[model samples]
Target: MTLTLPPAPHGGPRAGRHLVDAALWPDVARLPRASALRTAVARRIVERAVRRLPLRVRTPGAAAPALPRQPRGSADGLPTLILHDPGAFFRRIGADGLIGFGESYMAGEWDGDDLVGVLTVLAGHVDDLVPQALRRLRGAWVHRRPASDRNTVDGARRNVHRHYDLSNELFATFLDPTLTYSSAVFASLPAGAEDLSAAQHRKIDRLLDLAGTGPGTTLLEIGTGWGELAVRAARRGARVRTVTLSREQRDLALRRVAEAGLRDRVTVELCDYRRVDGTYDAVVSVEMIEAVGAAYWPAYFGALHRLLAPGGRAVLQAITMPHERMLHTARTHTWISKYVFPGGLVPSREAIARHSAAAGLSLVHDTGYGEHYAETLRLWRERFLGRSAEVSALGFDHVFRRMWELYLAYSEAGFRSRYLDVRQLVLTGRTTADRGTG
Candidate 1:
């Protein structure tokens, strides 16, 4: 049955009052009798659906809040948040559906007196979002695809370009000066003193320490973002080779290396890690595995193993989910695969261990710093928002800014809530008898 909403309310005073009128009785006075009957049926269905949730409607405060104008069809079963400027709310809902609600906040479409409080309430009631959860599961099943060659090189490049190549200026405005585009390690910070640059340095130092890096050592970096780690390694007297698919990253990293007079000791290549063949004293990949896709984990680990010298160690840092016997529901996975990070899936610890073991690598040390990542992202978001004007001037439009903001904030929330984790694993390819710590 078709559903019809009431005519948009008049502008100016009493505009808030008309929200109820439009939501309850959208204009259908002149419609045919059959059409009117269908509208009524749809309205009843919507009303019943809304009633099923524990929503607490509040009066408009200073702003004429918008309610969900779209008909609460089966696809719109998720709960909605009433907001000031209901027109903006309708626009978001129409544009992105349930996801739009969160996106709108990132876009600054609506603001609450207490955003954190509202989020807490919504998070507390997440269990009531069963229908949305089911939709996610259904999406996973109906949209499975094989991880083919196109998915790895070209497809992955396109995805990276869409997000990372937006502009180096934009990234530098928010990211730490080092421009290390990965999770940071904040091990030695007093409660709130964890700065991005400091944390990134700690991560680099941790990797170097784990690999037993020293002068004359050869270090290989997979997925070099802006080449900060390579430069740092070279500064410590180690020759470094880094590989990345992002053209922007390679060009900028190489320029930085040259500027530092480390061109002879450091090289950044626009290449895939699988194609890279070399034996190095140490290897590292920071936040690169997400794009490798779960099916390719074994190949990725094997590639790292081959690149490392006997008794040499490799340090890897990536985001992960808690152990799950099965992958995420289709709907959630598809959203990430489509809108966020195409060909990306966060592997569990068990999955990582199994894959590494199959690749002839033994985990020597493992650390979880998921909470530090949350703090890192939060700092990035604050910096990004603080420099919004500069970012916009750097050619980021509304949609692009919104996408980045949502990506940063949601990632922070995921880590903070423990729904996501960041892990650093030190692996050695030597046998137990050789290293004695297999």
Candidate 2:
């Protein structure tokens, strides 16, 4: 059923005073104190780890009572780390490990002269931060994925609501006019904010092209992100059916489809992909696989295989990590998983290939554009920071803003350091004759 919602003032939900009470926006001001021994150990480990890296860790007035001796690292031409509250930083890291590091930043305990650069250097050396002996015992100390973040149907809906159902104005402040939340494949390596809309269209068109979308073609989109892809497909003369779990996205997407006068050609449903039933000439899902969770990857791939008609194709744009790294951290919960996108895990290219092949889908084409994602995030971060007042007016506090800023910068650094990737993949069904060879 098409659920109708009264449009907000600007074609979205009422933005102001809605997100301040969001569950993800945790209060960072009140935290449990760490024992003195734990704090001392954390401070020592942090100082030793950063000592040989390209970082300049310092406190105000050249010295402070909390941090008596500043570490002398390879600081020439490196990013400077300014510690506002050294005691809090130590306590947080000592207690929560990496999650605490991110929380410390959100709590205003530290600031960096070059946020992305600092994160990039740290990301490059992430696997080496701890000693080999301690690394082997990570499972004992690291946070485990919570049972609630399991990505079951109910859990998935709740997780999606936690992030995507936040005020739409919050996303509109940073994203392009189309409201695309994924990475844009730009024609040039680094495009300006003015070019983001065109880049997003370009990205969508490429996926459509891979899907062979055209007149009279039946296109099914697994993720309906603001209805831009549906509108574009409808304009190309294709019949489009797109589904999303987000109510906010569905409401705005329906409004956008109407605004474009393509309501007859496009159908937007507030449904999950697994619940949709149809045979289409093409299926396209952009950057949605990350939220499928590793355990459900096979089910996700099987759904794509089952929904395609004869000679049909499925295209996906996914954020990926190294296969070994993905396996190592598959069950571990990090700050991003906790604060930004719950129940999310980026799959590896190999994992995608293996899962789809098992589901009778043949991998056809794969393209990586991590640099484009890096550039895309840089533009978003700058735009988001520039519009701080507007974001604040939307009822988000400084801690929420800091957490979001850190999320963007952390992701950008992952791409910049080659620790993360974004890829486009095309898959086709396997014929009975072809299935015998494997």
Candidate 3:
């Protein structure tokens, strides 16, 4: 049934209301609610997990018993989690597991002093949080992704618009002045030491360099992120064609290209990567592979293989997870999928190699910089928090703020704990014979 919400106050849906797709309504309506017994069990499991970690948990009342403390270390201090409403927190966890945990935070049931650090400890111990017997029955607890979230041509557009089109103004508030939205290749441990713009340029330059883009080089960018990469490539004397599903991004990118006086050199199209045509001397897509759900990984790689001219090289920056974890969570719907990026999955390094190889591309170079991503998220989260008033002025509510905070902090934790990574991959053409023999 269609959820006929009163149209949003503005032109588009509000921050948390993006799940307005009629096809997704049924799934939302059917979300499971935990029983009292299940809630009690979940509380015990959470308490057990908390006890094993180097974290501090404070309950609601002054007389309430707090969690055990950890010894001082080189780190700033022990991370702290304060459960403002312990009952709601555990009930949500029992109902939706991790997804509920995020909702509980958004509902102001809990908070963390060092959100990223606390989340990192939790991420590091994800495997041991639950007992072996319970782990085997994960299917009973975890919510599978609904079929409506699949990245079909039409579905992909909806998913992309849901996040990317949330308002360019909103993204600009957190992203660097350049509006680059992916991990930057920082020259230092902390991101802001050399300025984010320089680091972003370094990352883009590295990808272009690996693709051998130069004067008269024809470059095809699969994901046009505000035209930063295209502008940089055009400045390198390469004619660039970039594609994106975001109308907001395409319009802004075109204006940026025009402002740079590179309109003749750069073309930004509102199109999907799968539908892009014509061969190019080089291809570069930054951190886009993660959005191409695992079911479409083969098609995504095949598009790259089909789009490259003979001897042409392609460069991709991808966010990845361990193979086992990727496999285990590939179809599980979690907090990120529910509240932030929909219809996306982080691919594993092994999955990247296997899929790219099968698509007749040889992996020439691969580099992982997960720590850089951690630093990048820290910068973004801080910037976003600093501009909370502006974010609210733009129409997002308190719940939206908390949700975005959890999303960014949760992502940073994934990288900090080494549960996730960002990788730059360089691919070269392979002969049909080579693929067949392999």
Error of 3 at 76 (Å): 9.0
Q: What is the TM-score of candidate 2?
A: 0.89
Best by TM-score: 3
- Put down candidate 3 lDDT per residue, 8-98, tens digits, no spaces: 1223212232332334333232224689787877887877776667876775444544444444553546787877666666767888888
Query: Comparing 2 and 3 by TM-score, which wins?
Result: 3
> Worst 10-residue stretch by lDDT in candidate 2?
1-10
Clashes of each: 9, 0, 0
RMSD (Cα, Å) of candidate 2?
Answer: 10.0
lDDT of 2: 0.83
lDDT of 1: 0.66
- Please write out the lDDT profile of model 1 over residues 63-152, one tens digit for every residue: 322333443553433333434444444443433334545544544445444333334334444445335544444332233443431346
**Cα lDDT of model 2 by residue, 1-438, tens digit:** 111111112222221223334454453554445786766666766666676566566665543222223345433466767766666677677777778888778877678899898899789878887777667657644689898998899999999999999989999999989899999888877574348898889999999999999999999999898989999999999999999999999999999999999999999998877888978989999999999999999889999988888788999999999898898778788898999889999999999999999998999899999999999899899989999999999988877898999999999999999999999999998454543343
TM-score of 3: 0.90
Residue 208 of model 2 has an lDDT of: 93
Candidate 1 residues lying further than 4 Å off, grouped into runs, are: 1-128, 131-137, 140-150, 187-195, 329-333, 431-438
Best by lDDT: 3
